[model samples]
Target: MPNNRSAAEISECIRCGTCCKKGGPSLHHEDTVLIEKGLILSKYLFTIREGEMSYDNVTGQLIPASSDIIKIKGRKGSLTCVFFNEPESACTIYDKRPLECRILECWDTREIERVYAKTRLTRKHLVSTIAGLWDLIDDHQARCSYEKINRLLKMLGGDNKDDALKEILEMIQYDTQIREMTVQKGGLDPDIVDFLFGRPIKETIGMYGFKLKKQGDAYRLITIPTGQNL
Candidate 1:
């Protein structure tokens, strides 16, 4: 919060408009339609890929479009969030922006400092939830998608999605197998569901490293693999 009257790291902003220019934000049905008509155009419109949506025949909801979290790019080996606009300077769709951008601000230098301080520990802790994101993060030499940034926001132990889910969503869609893992210490194996998706064997739930056997039981989850995680 050092800048007080200014944006967090605002001095660092070059007003490049990269966030709005190079990528697409998730479009609501109306936003999509407007764009198709060539009316929703902005000086910084992006090339977007839309996702699957369900129909509601009744109207109002129109259509729901999901975007790929945030678009990003590598600048001199540092990855920056694509929507990080520099001039006229703000989120193009601030009122309806997604949770991650919602969490960012033009203040909070302490936050920026904290993230850089324990990055290695945080990366090791969060690697499983994100899996392959490290390659992308490493490509930029910055860790932008870390979900643990919000770990302090956890209020209860059971079902919820705040900081953690926001962190996960920042990089990827929800994995279907989160429910199946048997977490002995509140941690699941590192992003193994894809190479070995579905419920893992019950006995293997808490242990990490190559799953030696195919889980015979349908309902039991198993531990598959894990890395030292940093």
Candidate 2:
């Protein structure tokens, strides 16, 4: 859930460790710096293979970060992750974790995919070129369909688009699983109200959109239901 907390309000959370098992989904390049600075570990005690392109075991489809996502089936003992501290049921490194870790949650009300794309690739390529597919989506919720996100990223710029798509698909699944989605009551974002959704803020109060109004006497924002007339 993109961390609704303001920095001042954000505190280190207690270890719940539900996320330690997968290490994390695809991470940005800057994420490595955080880990290097003692923010988090490699997730794997060590990567058996770094960004090896292959397929998902369950889907039986080749994936780029095959090394991290699934173990080479039958090659080694059932390749469970090294960092999954099952005993503690918590992350070994929480204080210096990355944005991915900060956003991950065990569950959220939103229905999202279970797996997401991953790769040893740095984060730069993911955001600028891959996430740039904002032009293709039909919604203004700042979302890309799981299939669309992969297709667009593959068609756009990337060293390995096929691998990029595979990795990206993993990230998409992972992001949603972690509640890394932007949620709105009725597809409302003031900018998009002006742009995409095209629903007016005040004129059509009952329109198919969210209901919002000024908070206190200040510019703070809050949302209300369409029925409450807030």
Candidate 3:
């Protein structure tokens, strides 16, 4: 609701911390100093995969469109920014906060959007510090690319239909196992793992017009009626 106003009116802030309570700010290139100074740890941040649906802050809509956002970790089991001290209603690292935080004005969002459109911190930027982690992510993505899965699904219905379906299901199970082993060995955080690998194998399969049902340790595919949208 901020509009053209005097400097004093623009400076007015209630310090309610409502904005911080909603979610953590995305880090930008300008905020790298905070990480370099050790005020913010890489482990305390996570990435949102490209193509994933997320809020469009500039438009103020919950649209399924967003870039690979790197944001500070929120409190365990809540969306509140980790730096937010609930009782105190203040940011713990206010001075060294991310660029988005430093530029935000509750009364006006123009400054924030201008900064957001420039540069943002991404997984690639952190690759040098965590090369092995990035390698693992690349390996996993190569193995489970959606295009590969879609091709496998399309190969169905020619001959030996049942056998082909069984093979696809087994491949999915194998992919899941590989992800589990990688995460276990890498000791990467679970949130990071989920973001990198995306939804479970069964849910992903569903996106291709097939429903996966879990039976004990195995899986079964249930095809939807023909002509139904995938």
Candidate 4:
């Protein structure tokens, strides 16, 4: 059943703050200028890399990301957009907000949905030109990719469990080491690691219902019982 309603019929934003509170909007190629112009700093953003599990706002469920989803970072200890001033019910960057934010009409989401996943901006698009930096990001993506991690998880409980565990642990170790080294030696902002590498592998692996525990300088993967992920 199709209900006909023009976008113009939808009421304008009332500053309810629901959209900003839900989470920050994913950045698209069109929004790159905002970052280039320094209107949005790197520390204010993070990336959900390709194949990573991410919450889909429209579907209200976690789905594997199809590509890098660069997004504004949330305030500390909350998922609310950092740019959102809750007390004032206004976006600090309202005038220069991303495409999604400008097109989104909570009452009529048709326009936002049409361009939601197109022309997504990834770390490569933003940082690929920098010497030495892009190399590290590319290597990290290749070695610690969720694609490889998912494949390894499937091999667990099979005869290849031992081999799978070794590889998974190694990837997690590399992910951690590189982040620390990049922050210490590369002089990058500590918070920017999430943007460059898309969250620590050790942490995101929990999306598979597994976690790592350090045991005398070594790590062990443990299966979290159902309903215990909270």
Poorest 10 consecutive residues by lDDT, candidate 3: 1-10
TM-scores for the candidates: 0.19, 0.29, 0.67, 0.94
Q: Which stretches of candidate 4 lie over 4 Å from their true place?
A: 1-10
Q: Relative to the true structure, how large is the alpha-carbon lDDT of every model? A: 0.31, 0.36, 0.69, 0.90
Instruction: Compose the digit string of candidate 3's lDDT tens values, residues 82-162.
Output: 899888878899888888888788788788888875687766665646667778666755666555665667768677667
- Highest-lDDT candidate: 4
- Candidate 2 residue-wise lDDT, 33-128, digit = tens: 654564443223222122333334335564444322212111113333343445666444556544455555444412112333443433222222
Off by over 4 Å in 2: 1-18, 22-24, 38-52, 55-61, 64-81, 109-120, 123-230
lDDT, candidate 3, equals 0.69
lDDT per residue for candidate 4 within 1-230, as digits (tens), equals: 13245546658777778789889999998999999999999999999999999999888889999999999999987889999998788899999999999999898889988899889999989999998999999999999888899999999979999999999999998999999999899898998999999988888888889999889988899998998762
Stretches of candidate 1 off by over 4 Å are 1-78, 105-230
Report the CA-based lDDT of candidate 1 relative to the real structure: 0.31
For every candidate, C-alpha RMSD to the true structure in Å? 18.6, 21.1, 6.1, 4.5
Query: On residues 21-138, what C-alpha lDDT tens digit does candidate 1 reach at each position?
Result: 4333333322333434544332222211112121221232423223221112223223333344445556544554433233223234344233321211112222335555444323
Model 3 ranges off by over 4 Å: 1-11, 64-66, 143-179, 187-213, 219-230
Question: Which stretch of 10 consecutive residues in model 1 shows the poorest summed lDDT?
Answer: 46-55
What is the C-alpha local distance difference test score of candidate 4?
A: 0.90
- The TM-score that candidate 2 achieves is 0.29
